[model samples]
Target: MATTSGGDLSHFAISSVYGELLSEMSILTAVETGLLEFVCCLADGLAPQAKGHFFGSRNLGASGDTMRATIVLVDDISRQLGVGFSWKNENFAFLEKVAAW
Candidate 1:
């Protein structure tokens, strides 16, 4: 997968695998907001899903004399790369589009 990070939510593209999009994770579904709980349908129907924590945070700091540090919190899945991200809880999802693995 090729991921490009600009400033906010980065975009990821599956550089492999091609198949029918059985299901995908909703970009609006909050990883922390807890609004409408919607996960990847494929994961819900499948098993052997990993577990982990999904956290989105932002930080600011000053770099060297002519540099600076900045952090952007991506609260949404801009691209369709992210399926589900809660590994610790076994909550995961994945989007298998016209990609090749």
Candidate 2:
């Protein structure tokens, strides 16, 4: 997997894998606000048979330097959606799409 960081740990990606499930609904269905809200909305409209989806977010310190908390929220979303989750830094070559290893 590839990893990247910004300005002495300005950002990081923490990920976990979960057993795949029948997810016809939007994986990000319950996220109400923030950068994720748009991604969730797009995911919600995807066809039921779509294979995979992506959600990405970044923090310019709007919520007081909460990178760890942001990562945890993404993990929690993965659990709720019943899918594996991974993240990548913007500077990385490619996003590391992870599944339960």
Candidate 3:
């Protein structure tokens, strides 16, 4: 018999949820939602989860321009909310490459 690891189980769960959501929306909308979730996680200081969503968004075919726009929107929203949220972090260093590709 085989067993599922914790990471595997979590990945399954995430996939199921996103799959359902993606089924109802356009791919672009779904990707934008993923990016929004990533920013929300960042706002709450959840870097690990944020990183996951960032890659997920990219995997869903979000364009480099879309990702860049999301970054700028998040930054502006953070400023408007008077919160000191920083999107620049070591964990997100791959974003530029992801965006480029």
Candidate 1 residue spans exceeding 4 A from truth:
1-38, 41-43, 50-101
Give Cα distance to truth, residue 97, candidate 2, Å. Answer: 18
As a TM-score, model 2 comes out at: 0.27
Q: What is the lDDT of residue 15 in candidate 1?
A: 22
lDDT string, candidate 3, 1-101, tens digits:
01557487767665776566545665557766777777787677677877888788888888777777877777788889988766577766765675565
Which 10 consecutive residues of model 3 have the lowest summed lDDT?
1-10
lDDT tens per residue, model 1, 18-62: 111212335432222221111232233322311111111111122
User: How do the predictions measure up, each by TM-score?
Assistant: 0.15, 0.27, 0.63
Evaluate residue 34 in candidate 1 and report its C-alpha lDDT on the 0 to 100 scale.
20
> What CA root-mean-square deviation does each model show from the true structure?
17.3, 16.8, 4.4
Model 3 stretches astray by more than 4 angstroms: 1-29
Which scores higher on TM-score, 1 or 2?
A: 2
Name the lDDT of candidate 3.
Answer: 0.72
TM-score leaderboard ranking: 3, 2, 1
Give per-residue CA lDDT, model 2, range 7-39, as digits (tens).
323322222221122122255432223334333
Evaluate residue 25 in candidate 1 and report its C-alpha lDDT on the 0 to 100 scale: 35
